[model samples]
Target: MYKAKIFVNYKPSVLDPKATVIQQTLTRLGQTNVDSVMVGKYFELVLQGNEAAVNEQVAKLCSEMLANVNMETYRYTLEEVEA
Candidate 1:
């Protein structure tokens, strides 16, 4: 078995309104040390297959479905697990 930990996030050039709002809220709440906030998505997938095949599938899924190639980037880590 393989475990995939996927992270999807916007490109730095793209403005993240949600993250900006959160930062503002934090400032209002007296989090003066706050510099910035970034919003992203994290997904955990358990897949059954060989490492090579699983890696290919995970990459495909990240590009085709999990992230928008034009505006976002994705990365994943694979770990072996006992069935």
Candidate 2:
């Protein structure tokens, strides 16, 4: 078995409105230490496959559907899990 941890986030060049709102809200709440904020997607999945195959599938899914390659970037960690 394999475990895949996926993270999808906007590219640095892209503006994140939600994150900006969060930062602004924090500042209003008297949290001026905040410099920036970025929000993204995270998922944990377990697959019944070899490490290589699971990694390939996760990569494909992230690039093709989970994230927009033009505006976002994704990274995953695949690890063998005893099942």
Candidate 3:
């Protein structure tokens, strides 16, 4: 078995309105140390198949469906799991 951990985050140039709102709220509450906030997504997947095959499929999913390749970036790492 293999376990895959995926992380998806917004690109630097892509501005997140929600994060901006959060920062503004914090500043109004007398907290101004935060420079900015970025939102991201995390996913954990368990696969019961060959490592190479699963890695290929997971890469495709990240590039095509899981992440927005235009304004977002993603990476995944896989590790062997003993049963």
Worst 10-residue lDDT window, candidate 2:
47-56
What's the true lDDT of residue 8 in model 3? Answer: 95
Q: Write the per-residue lDDT of candidate 3 for residues 1-83, one digit (tens) a residue.
A: 88999999989899988888999999999998988888789998888889889999899989999899999999999999986
Give the distance in Å from residue 13's predicted Cα in candidate 2 to where it truly belongs: 0.9
Overall local distance difference test of candidate 2: 0.91
Model 3 backbone overlap count: 0
Clashing pairs in 1: none
For candidate 3, what is the TM-score?
0.84
Question: Which ten-residue region of model 3 has the weakest summed lDDT?
Answer: 31-40
Question: lDDT tens string, model 2, 1-82?
Answer: 9888999999999999999999999999999999889899998988987777888899898889898999999999988889
Model 2: number of backbone collisions: 0
Whole-model Cα lDDT of every candidate shown, in order: 0.96, 0.91, 0.91
Off by more than 4 A, model 1:
none
Superposed by TM-score, candidate 2 places the C-alpha of residue 34 at a distance from the truth, in angstroms, of 1.1
The weakest ten consecutive residues by lDDT in model 1 span: 30-39
lDDT of 1: 0.96
